[model samples]
Target: MPTNQLTAGVCSLLNEPQHTEDLLNSTPIVQILSVKKVHSNPNAPNPVDRYRIIVSDGEHFLQSMLATQLNHFVDEGKIQKNTICRLDKFTCNMVQEKRLLIVLEISVLEQCEEKIGSPAGLQIPPGDAAVTPSTANQTPAAHHTAAATGGATASTSNTTTPAARGQGARSGRGPTTFPIEGLSPYQNNWTIRARVTNKSDIRTWSNQRGEGKLFNVTFMDETGEIRGTAFNLAVDALYDKLEEGKVYYVSKAKVNLAKKQFSNVANEYELGLEKNTEIEECRDSSSFPVVRYNFIDLAKLQEMAKDSICDVIAVVKETGDATEFTSKFGRTSTKRELTVVDRSGYSVRLTLWAKNAEKFTNTDSPVVALKGVKVGDFGGRNLSMSSSSTLEINPDIPECHALRGWFDASGNSENFQSHTNSFSGAGGAATFNRSELMSIEEVKAKDLGTSDKTDFFSTRATVMHLKADNIAYPACPTQGCNKKVFDQHDGWRCEKCDRSFEKPEYRYIISMAVSDHTGQAWFQGFNELGETLFQRPANDLVAIRERDEAKFNKLVEDVNGHQFNFTCRAKQDTYNETTRVRYGVQKILPLDYAEEARHLIELLSSPWAQ
Candidate 1:
């Protein structure tokens, strides 16, 4: 093909003569001069279709090819600026705004040829060709024998011809690596330089087998984020060395299909660092961005469902009771509850368990930041705190001061109320009547004239008739459920279930009579508080009532006529919708209404009065 028919535009772009004889008759070959321009074509069906060229001596030939094709040339082909390419031929058709050219053939040549050659034969000088037989015979016999023995080695070295080297260099497996671009579609092994956004300290776990240590770190590259865990030996190798906010050249990581349900990121896959994984600290810190979060308002946390994780900033309004308990592992644990409030006109309870409880006990009035706190249900509303949750007390972070100022300026402190108004020494003394002190058996035995108008009230009642002594038994020690149990020796048996269990049951009250200056009421207590007030094991009380009624009556008399201040709470029962009240004696003191006893004391002290 001759090059004469090439257009002036092509000639000017190629900076070469345009002639039909040179294009059609002469070798139809050309060298890539330059990539003058590259851009996507909107008119193409595939939006990724692009137009580019190798300005071989610039018959500015425009070609319509897939975007992937251009990427292949840049990636696999290793084509770059100033690269030389030989264009065998191309299809050109005139278009309105831009010329359209389709590349038909191409050859990446090292350099431009000085002279054109015939299509039949191409030759080089004799010195450049392989040695002839005459040249080989000119050497000595001993030299020939040595050459024969080393012929295999010589052949091995010659086997990698210049052509082979060029092909190998272009195979996309060379030491001069390049970053992958336009990877929105391809899913394959990829190397990225990511920074250690978060790292975990070495944590040890002990089991029957042995004790081992493990740690994990979170990494973030420009492309995405991933989590890596190191165990045992790996922990010792990398735990102290891997620092947060430092970049690292990580490679040999295994890419696994990510479970979207378990991940919060946007990527479809995640990487795992294995034993063979390589990591090297990157000196340049400017390559990665700092970790940050736009925390959600704490007031909004009320609207979220229980167990929902949230980030919040709020002021600590008040600290709560610190309760200590034994965990399943037989370890002592303590937890303190606090109320955290924000500008949203809503507040939630935060229970800091274990270490957090002790640490925040003295932080009575400080602003706090909570991340990954699990919302929970407490007293019919959402509460939040978790073991993995992070709590910052009066941190230098701006959010802390902002929330503090807002709370102070808005008079938010005035709105803070005790979690339990009635139980926190707020409500005054309680009162109860004799009729309300009737035991369950007594109430059932009584044949009242009318249910609504029953005159059950009585004065000077003995504690013997007020307590459910016969029915009292050790109840389950579980936090919420406190049903009485039957003794089985091996373990206490639950009367409600007719089953034997391992854990020891607790003492709880089935009923109690409470009175004050105004009125009287019947009350019940669950296991823990019930046992505390009764001052006896529920099982022992039950046994005493069954074996010796006279003794039980004496014990009741000891508590009778004991004038004491009390507090009570009433809530409608779910079974009958009847109000069931519970009360505890707050303060017990000598009765002022005992006139006979006062006279006796005055008679004994007559000398002072005289």
Candidate 2:
């Protein structure tokens, strides 16, 4: 193909449905219409250079990107406005809202001779007439609340009121309410009259491209719902004027493709409140629906993976005192745990964090409707509130009323199935998973022993054998104390509580090999637990072991084949550069056949199982 004589072949490729991969494989020749730098960052760790260019098939203009490695084309002036080039190799991929053509291999077929006819703005292929460009990769929006907007409110006196902003429509000059679904990167002249269903706390972030603070709010109507964020200066401008559950006559909100991970709204696009945005409180909000919630049943929570957001309605079976703790982030946080149960007969712990925890109150068995709670499996399956999540205390919903009635009549203390901790709230008690039971193999599959905090679980296991190599240890006998005392030959020295004792008290430290069908684990049962397992106190065991080695050995053999429910605490420890799960037995109870059968039936009857 000669330079200028390449002809119509350059224009024919625009209509072909073949994309980036096809272009790269075929290496089609094309003409460049316009060139613009879309993104660049000298400070980026890997250094990025991106460009947006409009390529044409002579009839229609299509937007494409130049590969980062091809920056020299623009830097050295090889690619310029009105340049004709062969897209020898390129790739087409969807970057947010736009299908970008990334040119990799190319040759300059012709230099910028003169401006040819400007192809009409990209052709709206049949079904794409209403399609809007993707708003991703645009400048990040700042969503500042009235308080966080800071001095911006006081500095600017040009704010517009709802009536004044809508005056153009009254005059027929038109800034009419724009359909949220009608928004696009192509249009900036839009006015949306919607209700602010929800707004988030202001958050700040700093990055390579820039640094600024932002906040997000969701607006909805009978037609659909959309979320919008205001950044930096814009936050100060629009935040105070907009109120939750209030109607607003909003205009000039920039529309962007909604980031799938961060948004819960079903809309394909979201909006950004900018300086030019006009928002006026509307008088009536009959058009917008109340907050939307598609709650999942509490019984079904076990089926959900961690980090999934869900809503649920349940009765508060129990509540804990609001406690404070210094978080790793160096900030003090409040936490409160609530044991909640639904009609499905399954109960789970719900932990409220920070402000929500501080504000939580349940004097009685109140109905709670939580939205956007995160699924967590700390010690057990639980629901934790997220920063943006919301909860209602005894909401007026039918489910709430039905739960109250059910809980008050029967589901109170003894009837409900508790799938959580052995003791409710902050007892530091051993906990179970959603199934209320776990096999030994699951202990490793769930990565239970690796957490910084000790993990608790209960399993029905048989005691295969006892470790006789090390049985009881001498310890300080002080009441309410369980410290190892020094055997000084003449006298014992107590160091921990700090005191001297004439003689040391022996404490039971039983080691046992226990197993469920899945696997076996070495468990250490200390003092009380050891006493329960062996059916003998520490001093009695010490006397027996000292009295007759053969008698002590028989006691251990007699306990074999006995079964008990073992509550184990697992912690991760690294030794010789390898991490392993170390099990510590906390409590032990005689296995009850009736309780196990009832729990198994409950699991089988769960809605998720169905």
Candidate 3:
């Protein structure tokens, strides 16, 4: 294992059919010459970026694709130019008349400052060549290799190359099945062997076009996953034919740009099934992977943007009874909320809708695995299951088993931090972990609002003064909107909404000065923080100001000298052609002296304190 020594002739051996089996079996050391990031489709709603690296074996260099599972190595800067790595597992395939090696598993050996040796591009073999299946039934590794390499049946004889298969597929001859990862809009006559990971119930929609019934299913193979949809007659023909967790040979479907708003699959293209699309069940599906998940911890959900889709796994801590509500269109639906806690010691609320809400009855702290759940910013951070989302309770997966064991052992006794509450409260006592806590002096020293991105931090401070003038404004009353409205003598008009209202709703936009032991800074807050401070609505304060000015001033004075914990967001703001840092209140909570005392005691008892 000498440093900078590479296994030469590895790329040349990859092109030779005789060395395919041996090369696939042995791990080869190689040097990475360069790395490039490619977006599958730049126009895709949520584009998938993959890394392509050129690896050299001291003599020949070859282009390779890094599997999505190993993308973190590139993202985290572990694998880069001149880096030496050992390829533990890989598969070679010919795509678009070029050779490609898909790196499935790899280990970093060393980082080099310069290239190890002079290497030329590996020559492509003559004629249309493809890997042929062995005489034996395909093993898990062989099967995955074939899937990444594209097109091979279990039989050794009558094997077809991927290029010839594409041509044959169009000519109605002996067609070859393609892998899901290599599928694109240009290839129409392609078949794929994939398992249905999730299927949706049939639903009817009415739009500008005629109404029709449709459903969609997510398909996964060894390489990647794609979403497929069937409408009208296709729905009637294929709705019942597809089942979750079942493998099938699918062909003759249309490949088009993916509708990302309706799907969270990483693939850039989606399949459209027609009535004549061919689909058949594959009984021997031992080689296909069951499912793939990229779960985010409950605590990490706070950092993610709102409305993003993600996967999560946790144990059900508490479940609420199903509640019925009527939509604005008069359609009734049911929704249930559950509090889920993970090993990260954080809990978040998850809402289930419709049939899922009505049928959920697991009361013994079952492990819940959710995929494609939408994140929300309401009450800090929460999750809601969309129509395309999937939920599994107490699945037989290893993560579920481990979570169940932990919950049974010690989770039930541990107190969990909740996303909905600013602090963990018990018996009228609150606690702060102080992980994000900062002092006013530290906030100023860090220049929190100088950057383009907003900075969020928490501080314990007391209100010094409140500016009582122009503290409230007339705003449009539309839900989810707080645009200021203009009064035109008779009625209030909202330019953004292009509508007029009889009157306008009054909302607080108050400015206040807060101070800690170090220093003081001015902060601006909206309706929520204002109500919390005044213990009343902004409209009441407005009415009181018009009738009795003395009472309004007295109320503002009462809020002064009150101590609280504040979460604030700071960002650079441009006003009147001048840019400056603007501080806004994100959340406010009453100060908990008991928790502060406990935190101080723990800090004093630590060895570092001595």
RMSD of 2: 19.7
Q: After superposition, how far is residue 100 of candidate 1 from its true place, in Å?
A: 27
Q: Report the poorest 10 consecutive residues by lDDT, candidate 1.
A: 162-171
- Worst lDDT run of 10 residues, candidate 3, spans 165-174
In order, the Cα lDDT scores of the candidates are: 0.45, 0.64, 0.76
The TM-score of predicted model 3 comes to 0.61
lDDT of 1 by residue, 33-116 (tens): 334334332231112223354343333323222223344565554454444454454332211112233343445544432212
Kindly indicate the candidate among 2 and 3 with the higher TM-score: 3
What is the Cα-based lDDT of residue 255 in candidate 2?
69
Q: Give every collision pair in model 3.
A: none
| lDDT tens per residue, model 2, 424-448 | 2234665443355678888778888
- Residue 103, model 2: lDDT of 63
Model 3: per-residue lDDT, tens digit, 1-610? 3475799888887755333345566899999998887645544433457778888998998878887778899999999999999998776655443466778789999998888768997665676443344436434433433333333354465453322223211111223446676665434556777899888889887768878899999888766788999999999999999999898889988877678778777777789999999998888778568777789899998677667778899999899899775443334678899989999999888999988999999679889999878887554578999777789888889899989999999999999986532322122212332656889999999999898777777788899999988889998766545789998966888787776767777898879999999999999888777767776558789999999999989999999999988778788999999988888887777766898899889989998699
lDDT of 3: 0.76
